[model samples]
Target: MIKKITIFLLLVALAAAAGYGYVTKQVEQYIAQPLNIEQEQIFTLKSGTGFNRVLSQLTEKGIIVGSDFSKLVRRFHPELTQLKAGTYLLEPNTTLAQTLELLKSGKEHQFAITFVEGSTFKEWRQALETAEYLEHEMSGLSEAEIAQKLGLEHDKLEGLMLAETYHYTFGTSDLDILKRASSKLQAILDEQWQQRQEDLPLKTPYEALILASIIEKETAVEEERERVASVFVNRLNKRMRLQTDPTVIYGMGDKYDGNIRKKDLRTPTPYNTYTIFGLPPTPIAMPGEASIAAALNPEASNYLYFVASGKGGHVFSKSLAEHNRAVRAYLKQLRSNQ
Candidate 1:
């Protein structure tokens, strides 16, 4: 009789084990199955949002099916009360397991914005302010305040950031982007300074940066960067004024219309290269790597002047007469076009 009772207990245990195995298999299949989503979509998990809310949202959106999903999740991860919050791009046919793992990973979708090489600091700020995803922290802060936050010794804020497209997740601050760009600029400036050509007229890396900003504004042509750098470098070496029109317009600030008149050049400001005998007190625009490198390592040329070639380039010359001739041709072309 005892043996029969033992046999009955063994049968009960076997039945229980089989049932558990079947349930485990079902749960595994359920997790491995793809969701009912037909197309790609973006889902946001806001900060402090719980996992239950996330699950409810997903289910309501028809991204997930089956009423047992929540129960299965609870069975599998009862302790998982919350998901890391951020924007997520959900692809079609993504499995439940994949989605869960993605949420758990916490890496959000990254967005990109490019700061053009010759763009002003104000333009850069505008770009950040208008960007869709970036958090705008500097909207109310003055340039001086921003400079202080960046730990820049100079009160002025122009030309401090590096021009590059930076990728960041949503909830990222504009100041955060600026800080990264600033750090990048400092590193590049230091590295390029170490490799600068000998006898460069630049007194320091900051001087090189000022020259680089001018070079960046001077030409968009890649081949002309060194030539443009040479003109300014030679001018500096010979104590000739840079006489670049961009600086004149920059100095005019809000008063500058589309055209730069003779008076604007004659009107003196700290930034007007036409009036100033040396580099501007501060850079006028952000410079790129090529321009910065050209500033540090100028072409070995005695050419001291450049005029627009009327074909989207410049005509470099060693004498004022040649520059004058090029300027006359540019003016004539401008008149003919008009």
Candidate 2:
């Protein structure tokens, strides 16, 4: 009786081991399947969030098929401890293994550091100081040195970098960042220059950029960019000076103290269009993509000038006489409203 009981117990133990192995294989197979679909989704995990909380959130969001499966896999693999907290965009059909790999590698998502249209060099300098990718502070880089490093003929890079988000790899150099941005801007300029409207007064691509920079400063509204571009285009066609206040501000540089006095316009500098008959020697601020496009393809209008309408946009005119009248009306309106 004892021998029979011993044999029976041994058989039961073998059967239990076989069942466990089979169940473990099935669980592994289930966890390895792709969790993502065709659509892209953004997931953010805050610091100090527990693994179970993350799993629950993913499960709720339908990214994970089963919370239990994810939990099991995570428990089995303790090496995935390098996951950093940040926003992640999971592309379609990403496998669980791939996601696990991403977390394990601790690759933080890359984001663009945007330099908005019409931002001055001072603003650009501050932005660079804040961004994590730049090793040297903005103060360390002079315009001439940065230009030399980026292969630019002009010393100023503020208005030339082109406002856009650029993807950066880990450990990207400042020179490389400048190179990529400048290259994109160059391409846009070339394309626009080639397809430029007939009889346009733009002498060169640099001249076009200068005009674009002015247009960028003139308006923030998308609809108004073309109209604003038309005003400058008309002025250029008629050989009139682009007496933009921003140009005077650029020329004033450090002396501009939050106020544009009557004397500031008289102060002659390279960027002062009032002093210079043509476009400035360089751009005053970085132009966005739309501004560049608008500069190249200005609206066909008789508008030769514009002034702030005090409505967050510009009021355009076909001639100086009309422009002066509009300016008077707008300024009066502005004073009354204030």
Candidate 3:
């Protein structure tokens, strides 16, 4: 009878050992093997999100091999507790170990927003408002208040922010975005101002900024920017009216109907370059660093006029007669298209 009891005890101990080994092997496998996922996945771990919640998320993705054992395994291993919050770009079919390693690193999830050049402050605000994962706080504040909140020197938000793709973590505020853009703009503006050409009509960096905004609206072609700047500078030097239509549209403000007319040019407003002598009262849009550089260092040219070439560019001319010919050609092209 004693021998029978000993045999039964040995059998129970063996079964327990086998179960332990199997669980250990599965835990090791869960920690090592990559899942059968395809494509990069975007996983968001919100602030204060629990590690168990993270485990469940992995289970949902079929990444956890032994889901029941994982809870026990993690409970025994406390080092997997800490987690960071943001939008993580996860590689597909990544190992459970690799994913956890990334989450713990606190640098995996970063998002970006690209502020386009020639975008107005209103448009910039709208973009910030629409961006996912960004906390919107600027929507309620007035533009002037926003400028103040950002600690900017400008009275208004227009032309103060830089145009660039800004990278930030999730839950970042729109104000933070504005602050980064404004700071970048100021830094670039300072550097460009220091490197400006001699005898340029622009008295201050702000004046050059105003001109840069106008140049940004003029053309998108990289090579044409300096020539476009030259035409404006030449016109400014000769006391000729800057008949640029962008300024006229800016002057029209909300009244603009997406079409410029002969009557709009005749009407006088603070932003009307055709009516106003020099630079506009304020920048009409965000000017990139290149546009700012072009405004400060325009090429030496006799160009006094420019008209649309009807080929996604402008035809420049030195004299009024040549300018008139280009204008007539533009009108003829328009009439033909009609």
Candidate 4:
């Protein structure tokens, strides 16, 4: 009877060990199972969401098969129990273990919005309005109202924000992006202004920003920014009219029909550099850091004029006669192309 009882106990122990091994193998297979997706999928985990809810969501979306044994995965791998909330990208052929690892790592997917250099405030507004997954708080607000909300001292929003690609998580507000851009622009302007070259005609950092906006509009070539800045600086020193077409266009506002006639240049609006004699009352467009730097420290040159070369960039000149010659050449090139 004692031997029989001992054998019964030993058989029960072996059965228990076999059950444990079977459960472990099942969990391993569960972890190795690929997600039920053929393409990339965006998953959003809201704040205060629990691990069980995440699993339920995956199960509901048919991304994974439901199983009571799958929950035991967390018991084995304790790190999988802590799921961070944010937007995540689950790629095709990603295993269950890989997906859980990504969720636990808290690396949320990022979306990018770019505010292009030389774009006007109106264009920026349109861009913000159209950005995907971004919350639009500034939609119905006036420019002045938006400025006030951003804690700006003045209503002039032009050139206040920096031009660059800003990355954000899902549901980020347009105002939040604007605040970041404005803060970054202010910080960079302050630092650059402090290190500016001596004898610059710019009386304040705002003036430099205004000039930078004009320079940004004048040229798209990276290397030509300093030279373009030099032309404007020289014009400022000589008390000559800037006569830039972009300023005239800005002054025209919605009235500008893509063509600048003699009347538009002769128009006496505040932003029309042909008539204003000094810097515009406000910046014409957003300027990048390089443009701001070029405005503060222009290339040492006597150039006071520049015109489109009709091929790509602009041709710089020291005198009006030289500029007229360049303009004639540009027209000739245009005619030849036609």
Candidate 5:
């Protein structure tokens, strides 16, 4: 009976050893074997999102072996608990060790989005919506709400967000993105303001931004920016109204269709430069570096009027007589074409 009891104890010990060995082998295999997931698969892990979801997603995509190994590794290294959200490039042949290292390192994917020089807030909203990183609809968020989210002051986020190609992870928040863009803009503007030429008409940096917005809308030609800026400078110096078409468009607000009708110009609003204007209350569009510079250093010219010459550029005039003649010439040309 004693011998039988000894044999049973030995059998139980052997069974226990076998189970331990099997677990060890499985773990080793998991570490050495490469994950056979397809290439070109993108995984987006959002901020504050848990590891369990990542594991489940990996399992679903067949990127990892099983939940057991994933759970074990996660428990072992609880410090790697948080993952920064981004678009990750996935590979099928990634080893378990390599994957774990990647998770621990928190390497975020980098991509770029450019806000053009003259883009409006509405245009910016559309651009953000189309970006891969920004998931939230910009349409729902008010400018003030967006500014608050981005830690900006109330009522003016329109020109605050700079025009530049910014790098961010796919999961970057619109708020954070806007903040970075604004910071870059502020830096650029500060530098430009410090180096600005003396005796210019602009009162402050904000005023410079306002005038820059005007210059940006006046023409698309790079060489013409400084020249157009001079026209506005002359008007401001003489206390004459700017009478810019874009200002009227701003005043019209929703009423402005694609075309600026004759009545729209005649209609009165604070932004209608044809009636009342020193500078518009705010920027009409985000101006780029060149426009800002033009505002700071306007080209020397006596010209106060510019009418489109139908050549995708304008003909400048120093007096009302020259302006009327140019206008007549343009009008005649338009009529002839029609």
Candidate 6:
């Protein structure tokens, strides 16, 4: 009877071992199973979400199956329980193990927003308002108010932010983006200013920014920026009025209707370079690093004038007579095109 009892106990232990081995194999297969998705999709995991809840949701959405095994597998891998909350981009054919690895790794999907060179602060603000998944906090605020929030001593916010593609995660605020861009711009400006060429007419980095904004608006040609900067710098050294049309448009503000009349050029405003003897009080638009660099270190040239070539780029001139001829040529071309 004792011998019979010992044999029964051995049989029971063998059965238990087999069952345990089968369960372990099933859990491993479940972990290796691919998610049920054919294309890429965004998955937002909110704060304070638990692992079990995430698994259940995935199961309900048919993104994954066999949550029971996943829960059972989690008992051995305690690290899987520590899931981070953020927006995730789940790709097709990703296995359950990889998905769990991503969730626990805390590497969330990044979104991008671009601020183009020569765009005004108003345009940047509008872009921020339209950006997806970004928290808007600067809506309906005046430029001065927004500047104050960014800790800017100057009331004007123009040209303070850098023009570049900024990457951010979910729940990033508009103010935070502005702050980062502003900080980046300041750092670049400081670095450039420290390495600037000697004897530049610009008294401060702000003056360089002002001139850079003009250079940005003057030409879109990559090669023409330094030459354009030279013209402005020469004009500044000679105390010649800038007489640029963009400044007139900026000064006219809402009054400008795409055409710059002779009367508009003669009208005196703080931003009207034709009337103002010095640099404008603020930058007219955002300037990229290239323009900023051009402002600080201009090409050596005696050219003082430029006009649109009416084909592409501009015809630079060293004298007013040459500039007038170029202007007439541009008009003739314009008339021919019409």
User: What stretches of model 6 exceed 4 Å from their correct place?
Assistant: 1-18, 254-258, 335-338
| Clashing residue pairs, backbone N/CA/C < 3 A, model 5 | 37-92
Against the hidden true structure, what lDDT does model 3 obtain? 0.86
Per-model CA lDDT versus the true structure? 0.86, 0.76, 0.86, 0.92, 0.79, 0.91
Per-residue lDDT of 70 in model 1: 60
Work out the TM-score per prediction.
Answer: 0.83, 0.70, 0.88, 0.93, 0.73, 0.89
Q: Which RMSD values do the candidates have, in order?
A: 3.9, 7.6, 2.9, 1.9, 5.8, 2.5
| Candidate 6: tens digits of C-alpha lDDT, residues 28-90 | 888788999999877888899888788888888889886457778677667667889999989
Q: Which residue ranges in model 2 land beyond 4 Å of their true spot?
A: 1-99, 104-108, 133-139
lDDT of 4 at 110: 88
User: Taking the tens digit of each residue's C-alpha lDDT, what string does model 2 give over 168-204?
Assistant: 5434555666677789888888888898887777888
Q: On TM-score, who's better, 1 or 4?
A: 4
Tens digit of per-residue lDDT, candidate 5, span 184-215:
87887888898887888788888888888888
Candidate 5 at 256: error in angstroms?
1.1
The residue pairs found clashing in candidate 1 are none
Local accuracy of candidate 4 as per-residue lDDT tens digits, 1-338:
99999999999999999998999899888878899999988899988988878888999999988777877887877778788988988999899889999999999888899988999889999998899878999978999999999999869899999999999988899999999999999999999999998999899999999999999999999999999999999999999989999999999999998999999889899999998888998999999999999999899999999999997899999988999999999999999999
Candidate 4: where are CA atoms >4 Å away?
A: none
Model 1, 1-338: lDDT tens digits are: 99999999999999999987877777677667787877877788888877767777888887876555465665766544446888887888789778877888887888899999989988998888899777888988999999998898878877888998999987888999999999999999999999999988888899988999999998999999998999998889889999998898788888987998888888999999888799999888999999999999889898988888788888888898987998899999889889
Q: Estimate the TM-score for candidate 6.
A: 0.89
